[model samples]
Target: MKRIGLTGGIGSGKSTVASLLVAEGAVLVDTDAIARSIAQTGGIAMPAIEAAFGSSVIAPDGSLDRVAMRQLVFTDAGAKTRLEAILHPLIGTETQRQAAAAGDHAVVVFDVPLLVESGRWRTLVDRVLVVDAREETQLQRVMSRSGWAPEAVRAVIAQQAPRKARRAAADAVIYNESLTLAELGTEVRGLWKLWAAATTR
Candidate 1:
């Protein structure tokens, strides 16, 4: 499998690009989905999460209390580390399982949001595809999508690697700024052809 690590800052339309790739036959290993699965009720990581963060971090319905945990990790570095410790391994395991189960494919895109910040995923993937947009664009997109305040969007951005850093880490980049869906589809098709050809050889 030719592993492509896909990442972008919040609201950069990474998911849009990922969907386009999937439509073009790329196997997707979505880390965010894996994380959500592991945080669901009776998930593999739930026991560890509860043990680390206490039952208060679990909702009354038995799932992770995402809001509470998000708040904790936002304010506390130690809490962030603890949360990563619980979720990363589970996500990694599931990622591997999904990747292994995929057929002979030219591209298997690992849609990981923090690929740049993790400082480890770059070496694992055959190529890194950074879906990019301007900071102001990102902030506005996130606010509109999530109904978050400007400061909330900024806070999330602050925790991420800078745009320059993401660009530097990228082997490929899709400038997702102001492109219509049809335009984006054309761009993704071009990339899929390029990557699929390169990987098959």
Candidate 2:
């Protein structure tokens, strides 16, 4: 099996790329989804979170109040680190389990939004595929899609590794700027062929 780490900064179309790859037969494991599941009210990470941040982060419907939690973590570095500490291990365990369950022939794409920040998981994969776009495009996309103000979007970006740093760490880069879905799919297909040949050899 080829364990590929797919990553990008917020609003870089990482999910879109991952979706296309999934449609084309890649076994997709999304870390963000796993983290969300873990953080849900009464979920695995909730007890620790409620203990650390108090009950205000939980909603009436037994779900984590994402907006409230986000505000708390974004403002407090320690809170953010503590949350990551709780969730990262669970996400890593589930991701590895899913990858292992995928047969030897499987081409697994682990869609990790914070692949760079969560440095421990990088070595678990055979290759890093970075979905990249211009910084301005990223800001615009995030603001429009998330309804975050420009400053908020920039703050989120600030917490991520800069584009140059991420590109330097990447084994492969998919330039998403000015590309249509079909064009992106073509690129992914080419990469798949390369991966198939490399892993087979």
The lDDT, on a scale of 0 to 1, for candidate 2 is: 0.87
For model 2, the stretches where C-alpha displacement exceeds 4 angstroms are: none
Clashes of each: 0, 0
lDDT string, candidate 2, 81-137, tens digits: 888887878887898888888889998999988788767657888999999998899
Instruction: Judge candidate 1 at residue 85 and give its lDDT.
Output: 85
TM-score for each predicted model, relative to the true structure: 0.96, 0.94
Question: Per-residue alpha-carbon lDDT of model 1 for 1-201, expressed as tens digits?
Answer: 789999999999999999999999998999999999988998888899999999889999789999899889899999999899888988998998999889765478999999999999988999999999999999999998889899889989999999999999998889999999999999999988998899758
Candidate 1's C-alpha runs over 4 A off are: none
